[model samples]
Target: MLLKEPRLNFTDVMNRKAQEKGIQLDNDQQRLIRHLETLAETLLRRRAAFAGLYLWGQPGRGKSFIVDSFFAALPLAQKKRAHFHTFFRELHQQLNGQGLDAALLELMGEARLLCFDEFHLHDIGDAMLVKRLIALAIARNVALIFTSNYPPRALLANPLYHDRFVPSIALIERHMTVMALNGPRDYRQQATGHGVFSEGAYLWPASAARRQALGLPDASGAVALTVGHRTLHAASSPGEFLHFTFAGLCEAPTAVMDYLALCEGHERWFLDGVPPLARVSPAAQQRFINLVDVLYDQQRRLFIAAACPLTELVAGVEQEDIARTASRLSQLTTE
Candidate 1:
């Protein structure tokens, strides 16, 4: 009898496992995956195409999982995958020793196939830097994959603030094939129902509960929560949970910096109410979305909110800001 041979198509196996894992390997995703597999196979055969894939979706849509799994299946020497925060933090830290340009150039040079998870920007300060890094990545012909809640058109929204990086946005659009994955139900909803999430993960503590939990001293005055030695004054109200006057935080209205400072030592916060704004402009709303994005990327805290559930709080926000906030809030659930 002739011996039977076992044939395996790794791409097919990956697609099957991806579907089984509840990832939304939809038509677009499947197409992209097939294209990617083709590119990889081509590279193995002839090393011709320098392929890049940008995967985007709202939170809970499995952007991270699919890209990560895909990269993992690739040969170790051929891939470099990084969380967006990790890349920035490492780049920033390296600046002390190698200088900014050097560090960025080094990172771009190191990765032949790069995957950036939770890619976003709020502060225009970082926007220009991102623009430069992306340019370097493309120049090197690196096969890049980025996972973001926002699609490519929204990648660098409010470019007026990032005027210097307009060219960079143009470059990213030029290089990447942007794809969006939308779903019928939130995957996080299933997790929440199963008790896979811990209540304290994103709980926004009422002022009273926080004070009691931390054993803070009361003097009939506003309570102070310290982050990296910076003090945020919050008031204690009965049954209101830990309370903060939004106006106070936005008094000077330095949106990004203040929240960065406020969230310095913690990953999550429990906000008591919607920000105090008589009429919120699109810019201001974007800032709020940025704040949530940063907090969620850190993945250290979960918010327990009172004014609204996560979805509604960001729903009425303008079109530009909607994707950013909804993408983040979509991952959250009420405890």
Candidate 2:
């Protein structure tokens, strides 16, 4: 496929976008720009052995910012970008019905450039599926870019599964240019008047006066919602915004798929009765983390009514993405 050169160069585009937000790109982020420029040059000349760029860093630090710029500046006709978990969830939905060969072909329609944001894995099941996905991408000559919180070697780090993942990690190291965008500052945690997400709030103590003042409905009754084949019972709402208790949203058998499906129907979400992370079961804690990941990535508004403050709500949780969940939660208005 013939690709046209983008009118603006990668650095200039990144700098301009950063300036627009009054963000002075830090040293590491600037280094990322230079690497992206080199990668951009390679991409423009068509595919190479090292066709993909793997970007990883701590929570925030502008990984998403740079990826958004790079992904936007590319002038490829078949390019596709998606959130990591959401991408696999949809891919698995197809895989269960049609198998990998058909699923890969169907999911990745054309797409020379594939950008996946917030890429990481906890489950060995997802790790296996991702290995095949990478193979398919490389075999099909898809130029790939991934923004993740962990380096390829550190992904799926369970001792039992880590060895199984080495081949895939080796494949990643072999096929992609890896760069770390580490910096002292986490941009997402900064209160920068970011739209939509900034407008959302995290209200503590779950007070009636606060809820009444915000016009938020209470979880007075239970309502059943059909998500795929499962019937999920959430708290009653006034039909203006969707409302659910922490138990309903995370304590039971809810998964990322349930959040993805429900998110399509509702934009505004209310999660009340949230206790400290230490108090909840690990499964429930993980489900809440997944919930926040979906809502934040999509820029959906989330109003959390918790028993404790924001810091306490996420404190001492050692999940792989706990820092990210903290950074994202920090973005919301706290009352």
Candidate 3:
């Protein structure tokens, strides 16, 4: 997808790229983009400015792309950016050695600008940690940017610990502008001419045979080994790793649920079909989402084969629960 289009407004960048054509932003979106741009410009102008801005929308609404472009345009030395998982992982590591307060203050103090891609507060663990981190960052005058599927008010939606989020919600409202970017179509639907690759599903010859045939490891970086009755292939890099045609990979003596159980251990997968679940029932879709979520938590790299790219996956599925699954899918790929 072509992400560089001067004519496309910031909010519509992903949708535009998905089409490889332009999609105009609605008035509110245009205003939101302008506001975001102004914030970016302000940060550029002032060396020390700390604030938080939350950008929320359904999946494939272009939140991450906008943030990516915004930072790409800035000088690298002034920015500290990371995906939500990576940020927390690094923070936890730092905290172990330096203590939470010191680590939090040091990072907040050093970063003139920091962005958390796919900022989520759906769980109590994140809600508590984030509450402390935000407080420290705001006190230190650090600028922040985040993208989420939930509005600030709706974050930490877990009802069990919902009361704990009042302070976090209040902190966000007091410190940042919350905006929504909704569009008529999923930008992912425009991928009419692109191709995606996954190495996991490819059939390869035996180790000695591959050594003689291709003179290299197939794709998994292993001497070809068969798992169950299926052959696992190798790839040069983690991203180019394994992929499977949805039908072929899922068909086995074991039931669908059993095949899903097999995928739990894998951290990187490329699925190249409509995921039979989608064509079946709502219960199936929930299971599929669970499959997707498990892969995501393993920090797995996923490559989905579709008629469209990431955006269309959400566009094609109109069910509210399914759409939320689509959003979950989108979060793993970007930000």
Candidate 4:
């Protein structure tokens, strides 16, 4: 009898993960898994003509879940996975003195497959950089895989400046096979029944009693958090929970790495004085969006006292991205 080939496809791995995690694979997820399996097979074979994949969908649609599983199951060794924010932060730092080509070489060293999670476009500077990076990566035959909340057309959604990013958008459309994971269920919301941390771990309009419950002190004072060469001030630092006013955390020129460090150092976070989304400047609003993404990805518990409910917290600008933040916030408990 002939020996059977090993079942190493993306679908097989995802199905095994579902079984291990006690999750039932939905039809939409199964379809995505099949597509990813094909992509993985091509990459594993190092096909010269293979293009990359760009997976996008609404928040909680399992785009990240499926892509993460596919990346983990790939048998190749020259692969790198990074959250887009973290990747860009490092990329920008590396590109300060070095040219784009040199930066790409250093960043992509020994990595033929680049997997970027939560891919997005906002700043014009980043857009220009990404456009060149995409061209170079494609030319060098690096297989790209991205999971994002927005499609290529919807990226850099600033109405007045959207056209400026057309080149980058065009590059993505031309080089990557865009797929949408339009699943019906919002898995994050569905998981809320399990418990806060296991489900969402978000609290909105945090009340006085809730603050006391979390062991926040009656008296609050400023505390300094040192990240690298910079010192960030928090409104309150009681025990393991670090508290910040919305302005203090998002309005300043705070780096993504600072928020990442906070997430790593503390078990819980508290944000007070969260004004209506419309009230904040566009830059600050963007910072808040980034904060939510980092917090959600890190699975850190968040407590916030907001001026409006989550539904009304999102402003008209960047509605798609802010909607994702709102969706993730919904998983958290509100008093």
Candidate 5:
């Protein structure tokens, strides 16, 4: 006896998930779903021959949501999805004792389709690695899908050194179809009063009520969370919320994996003493930006008590990326 192949009904799966999540797909979202359905069918018929998709838009525009829906609907066994930071962290670890090509092949394993969320380039070192990785993945005929806040030209948009990534950009353009999810609605802001953290999510200037809601008792003791070989200490850990000073989480030598572990461990997170961008070191600012990216990608709720409004948080070289963090912060509900 032979088994039957699963039905390739992307629309039905997407509609079901949307209904369960109480999401009303907007016109732009529906159009993207249609495109995803078409891509899914094409890939199903010709997995190796099909080119993939590159989706770009501003933060909170539902790029991740749409891609996630499509990825979840795919019935193939050879698909893998991961946040870009996590993927690269693991990639670097794999590269320590092996060549780049060998490490990429190992990382991909038997996966034919790879979905990367929050794809962007900032570090020169990472750019070099990604160029190699892209070439290798395309050579292996891996169908690639990515969600990013930047289109191809805007990636690493510094005028001083953007040309270094031209080869990678060209490869991407040749192998993938780029589309923008330029929707009118900012779904993150529209998510007010929806989740457990919605009640007292965003708190600025550290008011007494905010302190109380964050469970910051005067006699609270220090708490620590261990991730891999490193331990992250918090100022206080009371009830479901873990509280930290801005310096403790971002200014410290914390990595993306540490932020991911923190999100996994705590239901609610509170960060106090968030100084203005002018006051933070460039390194600390970058860490803060990465922290925000992790939290947003994981859909983890955070309560921030900052010195100034979100708009005035970063004023230095990282102003562009920090602006995205501030946008996400503003969308969260405040007490």
Candidate 6:
């Protein structure tokens, strides 16, 4: 027997849940809800008015909450929702294993709808790959809905590689119902929610006394561990924690793929010696941002020791996604 999803408007379902959690949908969020409701109707009625939906905005805008609610209420039997980076990580492996068309077909299976959160493109290589992903989904008429911090115009935004993604941008514009929930409230920064991610801790000016009192593994005991082809030193505590220095983890040429691979093996992660973003090089800042995104997506517990408070550290950074990093970091409760 196919289970029936309640026929509530996406707004009612989202608002009721949000209220219980002390999150009220602002005007912009509600506007997006109305749009989502329309999309849901289109899907429910078997109408192909749009191939997908894209919601883009700054961090903490409750994009995840809203989209999850909509997805949960969806009656479709074949649907999948994933964090963008996490999905791409798997997609890359699959593409390497089974060529382009075969990989997508295997991934898509019988899914009628796919929802991706934290959709973004910081590298041109990923952008080119995603371009194919989007194009294939369109050709097969697989619906894709995305929640991103970057607008379509801003994706693959490196000036040197921007032109390469125009076709993907055109595909998105023509096929998807792109909505902006650039709301005033960044619900993530509020620090009131509870989750595996929320139970994590943050320490400012992580003094020696602080690390000791928190029972964190000493960085002095860091042993060299191989990640992919590179050897990085991190303190391993039993099977629970893997600790690294910011310089060793982010300052080096560690890739997001490394973080994804490492995170699967370790449940708890700690990073020490994080200087304020204003003091760090742009490349290092981006690495840190990518690290946080991976951790947040994996819902792994993270402990961060920084030279200064997160507020001061994130201030003066020009990275567009830094706000997202800060917003996610904001969810960390003080230890």
- lDDT scores in order: 0.58, 0.84, 0.57, 0.78, 0.76, 0.82
Minimal lDDT window, size 10, model 2: 41-50
Candidate 3 Cα RMSD after full superposition onto the native fold (Å): 10.2
To one decimal, what is the Cα RMSD in angstroms of model 1 from the true structure?
6.2
Query: What lDDT tens digits, residue by residue, belong to model 5 across residues 131-185?
Result: 8877777787778898888898788777666899888899889888888887776
Question: What would the per-residue lDDT of candidate 3 be over residues 185-211, giving only the tens digit for each residue?
Answer: 565433231122122121121234433
Show where candidate 4 strays beyond 4 Å.
1-7, 18-28, 192-201, 315-318
List the candidate 3 regions with Cα displacement exceeding 4 Å.
1-21, 47-49, 106-109, 192-324, 327-335
How much does candidate 6 score in TM-score? 0.92
- Model 2 compared with the native: what TM-score? 0.94
Which has the better lDDT: candidate 1, or candidate 2? 2
TM-score of each: 0.68, 0.94, 0.61, 0.86, 0.84, 0.92
Better of 1 and 4 by TM-score: 4
Model 1 regions more than 4 Å off: 1-10, 16-19, 22-24, 39-49, 57-60, 77-79, 83-86, 96-99, 121-125, 159-166, 182-268, 274-284
Best by lDDT: 2
Ranking by TM-score: 2, 6, 4, 5, 1, 3
lDDT score at residue 7, model 4, on the 0-100 scale: 38
Where model 6 places Cα greater than 4 Å from the true spot, the runs are 1-8, 48-50, 228-230, 236-239
Deviation from native of the Cα of residue 298 in model 3, angstroms: 12
lDDT string for model 4 (1-335, tens) is 98653334677788887787667888878877887787777777667763688889888888877888777778778999988887887887898898888988899998889999898887778788778878888988898888898889988888877899987888889889888887787777765342333333334555677767766543366678788789887887657677888888898889678888777678677777788888778888888988988877777777777777777787565545887787778877764
> Candidate 1 at residue 284, lDDT?
57
Taking the tens digit of each residue's C-alpha lDDT, what string does model 1 give over 110-160? Answer: 567888887876567678778777776666666778888776656657757
Q: List the residue pairs that clash in candidate 6.
A: 60-186, 60-187
Candidate 4, position 225, lDDT:
74
lDDT of model 3, residue 248: 39
Best of the two (2, 5) by lDDT: 2
